[model samples]
Target: MNAPYSRDCGPPPWAGSGGAPSPRPRRVPWLSTLLVAVLVLAGSGFAAKGQPDRERLDAYALALLLLGTALLLARNRWPVASLVGTVATALVYLGAGYPYGPVCTPTAVAAFTVVVAGGLRAALWIGGGFLAGHALIGHWLYQYLPPTGDPGVPWGREVVFAAWVAAVLTASELVRVRREAWARERLERAAAAKRRADQERLRIARELHDVLAHSISVINVQAGVGLALLDSDPEQARTALTTIKAASKEALGEVRQVLDSLRTPGDAPRSPAPGLDRLPELVEQAAGAGLNVTVETVGVRRPLPPGTDLAAFRIVQEGLTNVVRHSGSRVARVRIGYEAGRVVLRVDDDGPATGSDAGGSGNGLAGMRERAAALGGTIDASHRDDGGFRVRADLPAPVKETV
Candidate 1:
């Protein structure tokens, strides 16, 4: 099954300073930074005109405004420094008795950037200190500061500014949460795609294993017989070669079918999948490998779903092929049982284990198990107690959905 995708290997866009490192170096947001600079410069000129009682905007004031906005370029890489720099510039500009309007915009922007970079605590501390300093200078130090005979700023205005600060922090936190959620969703989608790709790959591998393993086993035995009997029994040699040709042809067709499905997954196969209906062919293939297979059907036969039918066919095929390749016995038994709500297949061969066979748990048995497990079924292959090896599959065969 596919899991959610996640990557701790690379950093996100907002990462830096107190946050994660960026996957790639972030480019400066030049246009937006310059726009903020222009707005601050224009707004400060207008504020100076309106507040005739305050110190007029001058070269020093222009330097402060530009410096505050300039710090924004480094906000992503050094958010904590940017926030502190901008906030301090705003305080110096205000401390010099220039009119209050728009001086805090750059500071607010920098603070928001800090929060986005996961420096929430740091932003809070800097913002809190700025507010405290402003309160002290506005209500207490006004007489000694710039414009003469001026009373300090009112408590009501400070309260409003505090509210605005809270709103900026709240908005920044919300944006951070939303960005993280979007990242999580993307990771999940990628993980799901990878999982599906893996399953399809495994399915193709199983199909090829079942198809080639059985056919090659038959071809191997027949080639041996043909080579040995070429001079002594020409007729038998020709017949063995013919069986090899048929087996190879069948293997090629199945392999091509599997590949065709891969090339055009939405198209129907050129041939239907082999089911129990092809049991006779499997038995015949076993015969060409010089083994006799006796098939017995027990209970009432019923139509099966496509998945179960194919699993049943492959399980039986692999079981017989195993007997041909591994068992010393010349005969194998196939029993198909149609019970309540399920179909059972059992293959057995009388054998003292072959020297090269380690209880036959190679790719073929594993493929058989995979097919059965895919359909919520179970497979058991083991050396039988009564001097034989047996492979059994019990698979669910539910009736049609509408029924």
Candidate 2:
């Protein structure tokens, strides 16, 4: 059976795979080309002595230098092929007694490219092959030719050559690992930013739903009452119309506050976020909408973190909105309790679940739950055994001394 493909280990999506042609490689950098050229020209000056003709030796050295430079240009596009060519050319130049110093430069550069493109395994194999070839060839040459200088290629010198190749391979591998790590970090940052944006969008949607749905439901009921009393009693109709006008105006102001916050610059003026201080206004609004609401507070009042305060207010707003819209109750009660390290809110209604209620699919309860969770709080909402719905929330806060 074929091995399964792992996305984590694969190349980036833009890099085609599965036999498809990969994207064109980037052009060779000018700095790299210049470096290669410099190495080749420097190598050409070190032609070995005792050639049959001095001029012919110089020409052969020039030809090898040009070939190495040309091969280096294609290193990135076909790194393995270019590496092989470079190593082979260097070995041939050295074998032909064209001096050893400059010839090794191209081989070192090729070893680096092999490691960077094909990883350490490729570098090890290619480097080992070159080392073996050099040892064999040097042994053969020393056996046949008479010694020109001291110690005929000391073993220490061969050790140094192997070390140079190993150093280049190690450096290339370090760079490749760092580049991959940077790419992975960038991907993670992008994913995190996307998640935050999604959460913000959901929160804003919930705010709009609670604001609009509650106000519209009240306006709709008052408008019907006005229409009905218009024929019998003008005074009551006027009162109903006035109530609708007030509810609409208040809703508009609240909606504008939300929208302005979204559009305003960070340093721009912004309206204060609603909190428990606005609970009385909310209760009055519900009373105007024909639902009797009473609010009770226990324990001492204290300041809260801005986030916790806003979340607390929203939970209360959502709970009361659900009572007004979903529960077919004439009276609702809101109870707020302040404790040593937390604040609690409980909104209960005299509900006998009506078939007209929007039911469990509504976003109001979900929004309340989300708000509480975001503030490291907890919320519970369910129908009571005594024939009413209850929403209870507990939010963390710092303990403050009573004034």
Model 2, runs deviating above 4 Å: 1-39, 42-63, 142-151, 261-265, 357-361, 400-403
Compared with the true structure, the alpha-carbon lDDT of candidate 1 equals 0.80
**Residue 244 of candidate 1: its Cα lDDT?**
99
Provide TM-scores for the models. 0.88, 0.81
**lDDT by residue for model 2 (151-223), tens:** 2445665676677666667777876677668879999999999998898788778777777777776777678
- Clashing residue pairs in candidate 2 are none
Clashing pairs in 1: 5-187
C-alpha-based local distance difference test score of model 2: 0.69
TM-score of 2: 0.81
Q: Candidate 1: TM-score?
A: 0.88
RMSD of 2: 9.6
For candidate 2, the 10 contiguous residues with the lowest summed lDDT are: 1-10
> What does the lDDT read for residue 339 in candidate 1?
91
Which stretch of 10 consecutive residues in model 1 shows the poorest summed lDDT?
Answer: 1-10
